[model samples]
Target chain A: MNIAVLGAGNIAWHLSKALIHAGHPVKQIWNRTSEKAVALALEIGADSISTLNQIDTDIDLIIIAVSDEAIESVAKDLQLLPHQLLVHTSGSTALDVLLTYTQKAGVIYPLQTFSKAVQVDFSQIPIGIEAFDEGSTQALFNLAKTLSTKTYYINSQQRLVLHAAAVFACNFTNHFYSIAQELIQQSGLDFNLIRPLIQETAAKVQQVLPQEAQTGPAKRNDQLTIQKHLDLLKTNPAWKLLYEQISQDIVKMYSKDTSSLK
Target chain B: MNIAVLGAGNIAWHLSKALIHAGHPVKQIWNRTSEKAVALALEIGADSISTLNQIDTDIDLIIIAVSDEAIESVAKDLQLLPHQLLVHTSGSTALDVLLTYTQKAGVIYPLQTFSKAVQVDFSQIPIGIEAFDEGSTQALFNLAKTLSTKTYYINSQQRLVLHAAAVFACNFTNHFYSIAQELIQQSGLDFNLIRPLIQETAAKVQQVLPQEAQTGPAKRNDQLTIQKHLDLLKTNPAWKLLYEQISQDIVKMYSKDTSSLK
Candidate 1:
């Protein structure tokens, strides 16, 4: 497969390399900042193009891995033939943006955070694939399979819901880590102390249901310890609110009958 | 050191097995329910007692692994001598709870969630230690050192704060997992799809600050995606509230200058 990448962000940087490693030639790399494009392209052995028009006509796939808001603008700038499939690597984005410029539009959201310095194992990462037509869907599944063993045919609405869930699973969970870090630091304890607990909490979910993996005062419905935690968070009123409210939700979850499960 | 465990709960069950595995002869196991005490004690090669009064005074250390609310009650029942030390494995309950019963009061709180079915590596777990006096402190440290290489001399107040912080890092984080699981399940997508993302979110914090590891629309101040998520979560008003407020806090965190840090 001949691929062209649009953007120099974390996803673009990593996905371009993974494509080349998987024996798919990344034919072109383009970014608003030509210097970044050139740097990434040189590292991945792809040609850096200053403009989308410079992309070769024979490129089979075009992957736009820019910010969610930038997806539409990047799609508008690109020109593709019927044989070329254009896809955005965003869970929150839909297929219509790319379909506006080309009949062949699709998405391959990696559903994982990326950093320029970190080399992630592509084979283990889950990819969500959606496309406008049967051919595009087949092409994307083929491309995604090269990078991952886990791929799902998620539609536009489902992908949006996945993004929302991803925030709770990743972004908001990291926020809890930050809150925990602050609480630990305020008491003159190292944040590293909670690392193993934090590691195991998430690891447990890999094997069990999050409901089954749940523990602590909230899960036990221990009101005394719950009150104690609320009292301790009095200085941080916002965190106290989260502690109280989330704890209440957990209590309700486990306390309720299983007949009402969603 | 000879040890006596005063409860047969999750922590008590695992800690007893871990103690026996560490070559400490658990002198006795007691619970309000003699059957449970007998069941656990038999598993770990220890005698089970119907009443805490039957605990051997020759035992060097007494461990009360009851619920936070029951810590005081269990401490009151235990029979000890001047040479015997008593400790409660609770993060929220102050050392004073045990002090009311004996001067050899201390705390050896294992800062991890445990299940009787799963065997955790005590060597890697962090144990928080606190005691009523210098001698008890040294003794508690000695005992904690045997269980883990990572033991901190935390005081009663710090232990409360640690418990509070732990609820954030572990309890609240797992609650987020439950919320995410529901969201994914509602969309007919498997919860397993988000496991890798959850694993990486926590694992990243082990090596870096949570602030540095933070990502998503909130970190980027991508208002469009944030609004989209909020709109999607309107069916679950509580989750919508969490998604909105937590994202706002995250936006403030990364946007603020260094001078305002806590």
Candidate 2:
């Protein structure tokens, strides 16, 4: 299949390589910065286009792997033939956003964090596909299947929820790690001490429900230990509040008490 | 080394098995519940003592692996020889608590979440050792080295901070998974969708600083998507507040403005 990748960011760099490795040739690559576009295109053996007008109309699929805010603007610049499919790789933007540019619109959101420095196994990552019509859906699904074994047909609304859940699962989880790092650093202990615990905590969730995997003072409702931890955070009022509120939330969750602490 | 394991809880169950695997002969096993003690003792080929008075004076070390609240009471019950070492497996409790019972007292706190259902590789788990003197410290260090490759001489104050950090890295991180599960379930999507993301988030922390690993709307400061998520969570006021506060905190963190939001 002939494909053209939009943007030269982390996702684009990874996606282009995965697509080319999956036997789909990326015909053209474009980015706001011509240098990045040229570099990525050279790396992927694709033509570097300085402007959207130079995008190959003969391409079978065009994937806009740009940021959420840039999706609509990128979509507006596309000039696709009736046979070509256009899709944006975003979890938050609705299908209608792409519909404004062309009737043959779809989504191919890769449900994993990507970094230029990190090489991820595309086969293990889940790819979410959404389209306005059956034909585009099938094409996107087949395209996604080439890059990943785990593919789901998620609609815009479900994708939105998944994105939000990712914030809690990925973003918030990483924030907790940052908080742990800060606390450990302040205490003059190596942060590496908690690495095993972090890995096991995540591994436990794979086999059991997060509620079942839950352990610690909050889940056990050990008020004395909780109080001690809160006391330790007295110098940092924001951390103290966060620790108290999250602890209270966990206690409330396990105790099945609906009483609002606020 | 001759060792006695006190408490047949999850930690004790795993610790005792690991000790036996490391060629340390467990002299006795005791729990408040005789049945559990007997069960564990029989499994590990050790004698089960029904009373604290039955604790063998010939044992080289006695490890109290009970709850934090019961540690002091358990210490008070132990009939140890002057030459024997005593240690409690607790992170938050101060060394002075054990000092009240015996000058030979120390800590052998294992800094990993344990479960009876899941078998963990003890070699990967970090064991924090703290004692009143060099002899006991070296003794505990040698004992810990048998069960785990990762061992540290963390003082009581450092251990307390590590305990608080564990709350953030393990306990609070699990709570975030729970929150993500609840949100996804409410949206009529399978919670499994976020499992891969959770695993990757934890894996990323092993290589990079958590602050460097941070991603998503909060880190990007994408207010539009943030507002959309906040709107979606409006029905659950607690979750809405959590989403708002954490998002604000992430923005504050990367923005480098030290002004507290609260």
Candidate 3:
């Protein structure tokens, strides 16, 4: 399958390589910054296109792996072929972002975070696909199947919901790490010590629900320990407030039936 | 090594088995509850002692895997003979918890969170060891090395710091999962959809630093996405407050400059 990737971001960088690895012919790549596009294209052995008009109409699929806000604008600019499939890898943006511009538009959202420096195993990554019609959806699903073992034909609304959930799980959780780092630094300890625990924390979720698996001062409703942690975070109002807020949230959610400060 | 486990909690249950699997003899087991002690002792093929006075002086090590508040009280009840090494599994409690009653006291803290139902591979888990003296410390280190491939000779101070950090990375991050679950539920999506992502999110930190591996709306400072998430979470005030607070914290910490949001 000949593919045209129209973004040079982390998602594009990884996706292009993944496509190549899966034995797909990446016909062309394009980015606002021609250097990045050219660099990625060179790595994937694909032709680099500086303009949307330069994309080959004969390509089997065109995947716009740009930012959420840029999807509509990029789709409006790209002169898509009559029968060629056009898909964007934005989780939040509806498939209609593509559908409103092209007859054969879809979403090919890789449901994993990507970093150019980090070589992720796409086999483990789940790709959420959506298309304007069942035929196009099947095509996107088939394309996704080649790249990843886990492929789901999720609708635009479901994709948005999943993306929002990703924000909470991925984005919010990383913020917790950042806050933990700050607190550890303030306590005069190396942040490296928490690495194992952090890794295990997520690993545990596979075997147990987060609510049932939850532990520590907050879950146990140990006010003394919570107060101790709160006092420790006194220097950073942001962190103190966050600690207070999350603790309350935890108490309200998990330990509601049990004894709690709230 | 003849090991005596002195608690019947989650940590003790896993640790004793790990020690036994590592080719050590679990000589005796004791707990506040005689039945629990007997049960655990029978499971591990060790002697069950109801009272501390019944403890055998033949064991090479007596491991106190009790609670922080109960450690000192339990230690006072136990009478250790000379040259018998003693250690507590409490992360926050100092090694000195055993110092009052015994001459040779140390700490052997497993940096992984344990639940009764889930069995952890001790080979991958990092154990933080602390002892009052050099000789005792070496003994604790050797014992920990037998149980786990990753053992750190961390002092009491470092253990406390690590414990606090674990609460942040493990406990607080679990709360983040709760938040994600809550938000996804509010969005009318199944929580299971986010479970795989939740597991993968924590798994990523093992390979990359939290800061470098950070992603999502907050990391990008995507105000539109943040506001949209806030809007989605508005029905749930507690979650809304959490989302706002964490998003703000992420922006303040990771954003290029702190000029705005000031």
RMSD of each: 1.9, 3.0, 3.4
Model 1 chain B: worst 10 consecutive residues (lDDT sum): B253-262
For each candidate, give its TM-score against the true structure: 0.97, 0.96, 0.90
- Order of candidate numbers by TM-score, starting with the best: 1, 2, 3
Worst 10 residues of 2 chain B by lDDT: B253-262
Compare candidates 1 and 2 on TM-score and give the better one: 1
| lDDT string, candidate 2, B53-169, tens digits | 998768889999998999999999877788989898998999999888799989999999988888899999999999998999988988899889999989998998899999989
Models sorted by lDDT, best on top: 2, 1, 3
Tell how far residue B236 is off in model 3, in angstroms: 1.7
Question: How many Å off is the CA of A105 in candidate 3?
Answer: 2.4
Error of 3 at B142 (Å): 2.8
Candidate with more favorable, higher DockQ: 1 or 3: 1
Q: Each candidate: fraction of true contacts kept?
A: 0.77, 0.74, 0.64
Judged by DockQ cut-offs, is candidate 2 incorrect, acceptable, medium or high?
A: medium
Compare candidates 1 and 2 on lDDT and give the better one.
2
lDDT (0-100) at residue A258 of candidate 3? 67
Q: Cα deviation of B249 in candidate 2 (Å)? A: 1.6
In candidate 1, which residue ranges exceed 4 Å CA deviation?
A: A258-262, B257-262
Q: Model 1, range A1-262, lDDT digits (tens) per residue? A: 7889999999999888888888998989999999999999999988999988888988989989889998898888776777888899998888887877887889998988787755678888899999999998998999899989999999999999989998998999999889888888998998878999999898888888888888899888899988888888898888888888898889888888353675
